[model samples]
Target chain A: MKRIILALAASSILTAGAASAETLKVCAEGAYPPFSKTNEAGDLEGFDIDIANAICDEIGVTCELQATEWDGIIPALLEKKCDAIIASMSITEERKKAIDFSEKYYNTPARFVARSDADFTIDEDGLADMVVGVQRGSVHQDFMEKTFPEVELQLYGTQDEVYLDLQSGRLDAAIQDSIAADDGFLKTDAGDGFAFIGGNQNDPAIHGEGAGIGVRKEDVFLKYALSAAIAALRENGTYKEINDKYFEFDIY
Target chain B: MRFELALQHWEVFASGVWMTLHLTALCLLIGGCIAIPVAFAMLRGGVSGWLATGYVYLFRGTPLLVQLYLVYYGLSQFDFIRETWFWRPPAYLRSACIEDLMGWKVCAADFIPSLRSAWWCALITFSLNSGAYVGEILRGALKNTPKGELEAATALGLTDKQVRRRIHIPSAFRRALPQYGNEVIFMMHGSAIMSVITLQDILGVGRWLRAKYYVPYEGIVASAILYLVITYLLVFAFQLIERRYLRHLNIKAPGAERGWFGRSAV
Candidate 1:
């Protein structure tokens, strides 16, 4: 009877491991809107949330969405706070040096937005005296520093703060992802007087290929699984469905 | 491992230290100026005294972070605050006689372009917050001043102003120094939050490094050590100041060996 109980307990432990094998914890930046944000009811919602869910559904895995600060999200993933990052993080060489990224899920260009009454242009010379704002720890900030070396750049903790400062005339202009500026701010009432001042900045050197699901560098199996799930979502038109909900154009 | 990365980026850490020191010094200097008059007002005990006390309560009652946000972001929300000249000094500074005596123009715009600026906002918020605490500390120190000294100064035919300047204020300041020293160090720690507004102070640069490298431990540890060193230097400087000003109070034991940190043989 003791031998039988020992065998049963060993089998239960293996079964428990198998049961939890398909469970994936995914993290997203709660502040980035139209991609991922916490709604009035305090639940995660938006395009990234839907895409994360769709990827999990395609792979037949249960997923949990964790909200984290954008600045600390990458560290949180590596620390095992979550298994993946689907918070619209662009695939970059600098980031890939630390962690692995799955296939690009979406591609968006950076744009400069300023108050309508502000007659400033977006060129380096035009923005000489202007104080431009960008979200800290973002590709936009990297691009702003490289492209507009002469212009003063202010880094904000959140994209929403850029909009606030722009409204108050504190920030002369702001550089951000085109869609975030459009759907997250410009499409809203707070961004009424503001308009996109410059054309799309799609310099690959700074913006990178596109947004991807980030995973641990050693998690090759998980990375492939996510890539396959993304492909499945694309083939099954789920990607297009989510894209249409948040954006009018195909971001893929 | 992070320490290696932190050492690799020593320049960033150095600049961070400079910015933290800059913020701390500005807060203390400006806040000290605000504290003196408020301390005197509270001691005077009138309607204006209650007003001064209320100012202290309002600022001290709230968190420094909240006060910072209120000045930096909250005040910018108001149209009047944004458009008006509320950021300029009081109308009294415009007095012709006072301006001539100072021999410098008192134009706020000549110094700062706008009060809504992040640097100004941070400075103002920190100064106001530190002023409240410093004012309270000074009040307590002032009250602890011996009444006999003031009576003696009066008996010596000293005016009320003379008595305050000669006997009361200096003694009160000497008493307040140790506590003020701690407050200064607290301000240094508090200045780390200035990075939240994108000030690029030591803590700001530390967070920037952490964000860039994704090695949070190294940058965090480096900043922690930097702050620790800064606090130690401040404490050492204050000890020297105490030794200089409060030398009469220390009854040195004969043949006692001094330790590395100014501690006696005991």
Candidate 2:
């Protein structure tokens, strides 16, 4: 009886393999530059996309970037809209609820943006009575609201929209990832009159260490593979190679 | 996951929720106001109507994100739009009342986005898309009007305009009531998509909450609650409208709708 059961189990596993083998479907917000944005030809090109591709290459698995909206990215992942989220999403205590995150990959400073004319430097020491704009559902929003309620905090839908208002002079300044501010707004004519206020501040309590890949908690095997792959890539110069291509500085 | 930890920040979350509700409501009110005329002109106007058709088609068909980029980024690229009558009021500056500030001049056109981009994006999409849907609804309701009623009005020496205004529109609205309610539901759901362009709807807050705690479950749950609340409110409002408009529905029994269900029912 035991032999018969064991043979059936083995047969089922083999048949399952024959029926379908899984490929890693990586999710990235193709609109976000440097971290994850699309090229003119609609190709995924960003720091996270490069890293995901390299990791897949190392694992000898076919990895695909599935462009999805940032708001629904996590929900889509939970519903299997793709396999993982490699977007520069922070691995915060709150996000860990629905899905699991890989180890911290990169840590970027969070800064507030103001029009060139506005002298409001975000009082990193205290936030009160100052209105700050940050992307809705970003660490910057959480930090501003939680740590500095004294200031007015405005939340936008995407990283770019936050800067649009800053340049238009509707906001005192926008609070966002420095890299995003630098790549998305700082380098452009829209951002010509803008400056990063309050220097780079790292408040890990609010701004969780830089983003990590997201996977279903039940995806134990894939998670283990990704965690290992991430470590190896960091040890090698692969991480730096990808980072230097788009950004002036290595994000990791 | 400790629920209390999140509950501790309930005030902030509450504020976010309130803002989202206010934003959605304002955008809908504003977007709807603009769309009605735009749709009417498209259907009624001559060559200029084609422009309306194009406007509706482009805004309705494309994803909200692209539209937002085209609006926010694409517009800023041109010096003409920045200088044109459209970009009036000189952008959001000084946080003071200047009555002359008109069009895209308010800083929020780019800066303080409570719901304007979401509104513009939503309005453009909502007004245009809803215009498309409402246009079809209007067309159908117009066609569905009883021929006998129009003949009777004509017999009374009423002009086409008077007949439409006094009798046709009112009767047609009554007929379109249920379907219009349904459209309201769809618009409510469609509003969630606005979050992509960064409208901080309930879903937006849920995402931020998730990003903060790394607790996707909690944030998602909170989002579900928010959605449920908004949906419930919309549905409640829909019910109120139905009850008010379809009060006649109550006096009749089931299957007694005497709808325009063809002569077979009579």
Best by TM-score: 1
lDDT, candidate 2, B94-192, per-residue tens: 354435576434343343322323355455545555655655565467667889977887888889888878767766666777777676666666666
Which regions of candidate 1 are displaced past 4 Å?
A: A1-22, B2-5, B85-110, B152-159, B253-266
Fraction of real interface contacts that model 2 preserves: 0.27
> DockQ of each candidate's interface versus the true one?
0.53, 0.22
Question: Roughly what TM-score does model 1 have, to 2 decimal places?
Answer: 0.86
What are the per-candidate TM-scores when only chain A is compared? 0.90, 0.84
Clashing pairs in 1: B16-B202
TM-score of each: 0.86, 0.66
User: What shift in Å separates residue B254 of candidate 2 from its native position after superposition?
Assistant: 12
What is the lDDT for A223 in model 1? 74
Tens-place lDDT digits, model 1, residues A1-252? 323433343343235343355667888877778897789999999999999999877766667888887877888887878888999999988798899999999998889998877787778789998899988789988888788888898887778778888887778899888898898888899889888887888888778899999988866666777887788788889999998988888899
Give Cα-based local distance difference scores for all models. 0.81, 0.66
